[model samples]
Target: MSLVNAANRFLPSDTPAAFVADAQRVAVRGERVITLSMRHAGARQVALRYELVGAADAPVVFVAGGISAHRHLAANADFPEKGWVDDLVGEGRALDPANRRLLSFDFLGADGKLDAPIDTADQADAIAVLLDLLGIEQLHGFVGYSYGALVGLQFAIRHAARLHRLVAVSGAHRAHPYAAAWRALQRRAVALGQLQCAEDHGLALARQFAMLSYRTPEEFGERFDAAPEVVNGRVRVAAEDYLDAAGAQYVSRTPVDAYLRLSESIDLHRVVPSAVAVPTVVVAVEGDRLVPLADLVSLVEGLGPRGSLRVLRSPYGHDAFLKETDRIDAILATALRTTGETA
Candidate 1:
């Protein structure tokens, strides 16, 4: 199914912006309208636009996730609907806006259509510029998942002193063969001669495949054991409902081009040891199909003693970062506390 196909099925009359509206509401309170604007990309010489949220003078955290322009979690409404950050920003979460400044933005890259060449390092540097705009001299931490994790690694390497700690979940400093292969297909899907073809069927199938890898067999089986009874000729199992809901949700909030840019950059990551001096923590999932455990292990080993690693036993694959929040919270709280004292 293509993004268009899925969108037609669930939201034939609504736009992706509608989902963004609802999610933005969940993230902010009264009078906080979703803000979008263009920022000068110092390194790339192009004025890259990004969507931004939160306020200043608070401890800051910068986020980048796979090829998304700051709304990947909300894009998939079924698994996460709102996003992992939503929990943190809520009244009682660690990132309560009352105390910390949370920054999430789209990286400079290929055009919104995902047809251009976007460098991961450049995107990281662009974010650094965004920090300068916000007058943040240093960050409490740089956090990421999947592609965002790759961006976080790049940030840690390029501006180590500027970041206190790096939290990478289901991400690696380097791209593995499996990730490369999967990314290639996604790219091919979006690169079809006709743009509509890529965005509709190609990217749709790509998302479906990516979703499969993001979850484990046990998780999928448990949730989808019973086939969806054909009601009105549509069989909607819990698992299928979950995926479609996620897909339909994102089709509106995220553009196909953004996904291409981020996914490609993630596929081409390489670490520069001399550039990475900050403390780092790499969070691995037991069943990440895109990035295997060995890849994360290598990242931890290469980061040395100050760099630590922990793995979560989740059958949800890479989606564990959202599905299994308790463990995520515990690990993050401990890591942040440890960094506050040590870094």
Candidate 2:
């Protein structure tokens, strides 16, 4: 039986009815959650919730995004909620499921209680295991954005034979020191929140801070240049409200511990670009403060002739991959059309 169908049989008798009901609902949507024993040091096992959509004999393409993204890539008959990257995939989209098998899964430390550190290598290994389980021997391409790009690079480095091409968007071989510093402060904020017994508040604060780095000063200046106003006896800038809303929305979906683990994972991520033999298309946004253009240039150079760089200009900064859909879709089409041979 598929994992989703068999999951209920193993649930403890005392399991909440709501939990069981949710599982059944997911099964109806054709989403599968399977537990895998991990070989990594920090984690013993992880349950990966994944969705495979498309023709039975189509080429498989692995798609991933930042820490916040899950397996659902688009809305369909079973799933009504719009996907995180619905603009880039779906019917008549760049990665249309009608012709391609799209594979995506949740990150291992996404549940907020892993307690163990998760390396990108662990994520790569988990993908390999899932592919083995599904009897997929090779992937036509791996398209990853942000943190997912880091994991894609690791996958290409460790499992080069299993992949044909890679499209890494808004990510680099290592975290920029400035970006790492920002993440460190975010973690400290969460730690402070824990000590104060206000974990969610801390997480929200951290997310608010993250929004600053994820976007550019130019964008902020354009969007929040209005005069500060006094509200409830306190002066507030237009930007503060935007950041607060972003933080609150983030906290509603993300757990405090999950944020901490994934934030650390981004800083801990390191890969030797030269080791990646797969043909790679590196997409960098002009004003992405999180992943500097210089770092991406260095990454492409390090890969020698195996990698090609594509630069795009956007006011959205690091979020260009999510906002500049037309441009990203074009890049995806070109990259996916190429063979595994080095550029």
Candidate 3:
């Protein structure tokens, strides 16, 4: 069934005719918002906004990134802005839109107004509802990075029959305690900033701290080993500028509430690897601080014979999935090919 027809079945009879017609109009590449009943108690219902790209009849592939990522997976005439992961989803890329339909969406707490924590399972259920609305019975593959990876694992466990393959990168079955502690600090910073009416300052500080966790000391040492310089009568370290820029950029686009909620969500994430029956490929970075290599190793082992691990040595730390494009592309190509299809 087409998305319009499927939506008509779920939408109330009193739903406006124009709203239903709008759904039909943007069925392919434009953004579509659907109201879904959530699985958790914090919020029972949510407005999920998603976008579909590529051939209308092609096999569906769900792609997601970190908390900040949105529905735009690739650049097109409709969306001129560069995609968050353009390196992995373009012509002849691993998730090429030529033969595979790409689906992506914003997280529930994206707007930062969430009052309660949302589990990874909640995100998985949201994706399941999206598939149903789009008339997609099963996904060809799910490619997730960071927080998205956690959601993919949950999806594979909760809706095992809804997907054929799972590719989880830079995320494990659960957040490591050390990683959760770092996130707690970030949340505390945001909270303190809110209390002082310095929400933006707190958010920037939180993001600056987050950047440190996403990368490594080795990388910082290599890139910012320059001698401290005095500017405006104050000594400034080389790394301070980079961290400041990252923090400022984050503050410009991310709301304080959203940052706190999502940061807490990441720390609260947990899943049972044994419950995930789908064929899985887990990717780990050599020096990742957030998701320790041991955690990922344990996750693959828990999956038994259905799981495999690929480790990449990189100085980029946890952000290797984003910075090491060529290597990630190669891994994705191999993982996505297991379905006996090419894109």
Candidate 4:
């Protein structure tokens, strides 16, 4: 059955935003009013966007990724063949959609609910509520990358009984000081843009910094040769052209307020790994500068007996999850085996 049919049968919502359906996608809006601080804002209404993929009776596997990532988890008409994990997840692939239904949602603190600064715990709570609303009492497993992985950590801690196995790739339980500093600079750039009545420019500037942090020196050295833009055989700092284009594209679609709220919330998020009862795998990229090796090692040690860590050597740095396919698939293979699909 299509997601629209499934939601109509289970959700029964009449609101337009509650169910935004079309020929290509079935998107749902999870609405709730959060009681915020009276000093600033007493309460705020939030509508989280989500999408479900695969069969009705299949075991559910929750998937989440970066901040900009939305609910398009696979190759649909709207997304063409560029779903975030399009290569790793499919029929006969790791966490095959044919065997396990996939659930994905937009990270809160984005455009939908910019009023409150939420922690990853809030994101986890939203996941629990979404699963309950969907009538999914339990999940076969949970997989998250980057920001999604942090949410997965919070989920494992907050809802230990909800899933059998967990997978977190290229995410840290706690924000690193160095990483926070870089993000702070990015936020600062955005704040400046907000202050100057040029949020679009701010957003683009922030993205430039982000692009650098997301990538590794190896990639730049191999691809761009650390040079400027070369147009018509004219070299004028091409990296600037790339950053400009990237930032411009990001700001064009993303809301400035939402970016500030979500990026700042990430810095405030913290979790006690030892408190996590669910069996978990913490995957780290060796070249990832955004998250320190010490931090990942600490997370594994904190996992106690049921916890283990896998460090994949790659030149992709923090973006390894998107680049190193075979390695990521191998890790997912273990998670699938460990989670023991019930469908």
Top candidate on TM-score is: 3
**Which lDDT tens digits does candidate 4 get at residues 1-343?**
2222233244323224223322123333344434332212334555555667665556778999877776666674333435666777776667675566678876766653465667888788878877766667887888988888899999999899998888988888799989989999998998898898987888899989999988888887787765456679977874676777888778766777677777877788788889888988989988788986678899999999878899998888888888888789888877766344432
Q: Write the per-residue lDDT of candidate 3 for residues 48-75, one digit (tens) a residue.
A: 6676767656777899889877766666
For model 1, what is the C-alpha lDDT against the true structure?
A: 0.63
- Give the C-alpha miss distance for residue 134 in model 1, angstroms: 1.7
Candidate 3 Cα outliers beyond 4 Å, as residue runs: 1-43, 231-234, 338-343
State the weakest 10-residue window (summed lDDT) of model 1.
Answer: 28-37
Distance (Å) between predicted and true CA of 132, model 1?
A: 1.5
lDDT of 1 at 86: 54
Q: Candidate 1 lDDT, tens digit per residue, 233-334?
A: 876666766777666655555567766766777766777543568888889998788789988888888888757889988888888877777777677666
Give each prediction's root-mean-square deviation over alpha carbons.
8.1, 6.2, 5.8, 5.5
lDDT of all the models against the reference? 0.63, 0.81, 0.80, 0.74
Backbone clash pairs for candidate 2 read: none
> Where is the poorest 10-residue window by lDDT in model 4?
17-26
Candidate 1, residue 4: how far the Cα is off, in Å: 17
Candidate that would win on lDDT: 2
Give the residue spans of candidate 1 off by over 4 A.
Answer: 1-56, 69-84, 110-114, 192-198, 227-246, 273-275, 338-343
Candidate 2 lDDT at 129 equals: 78
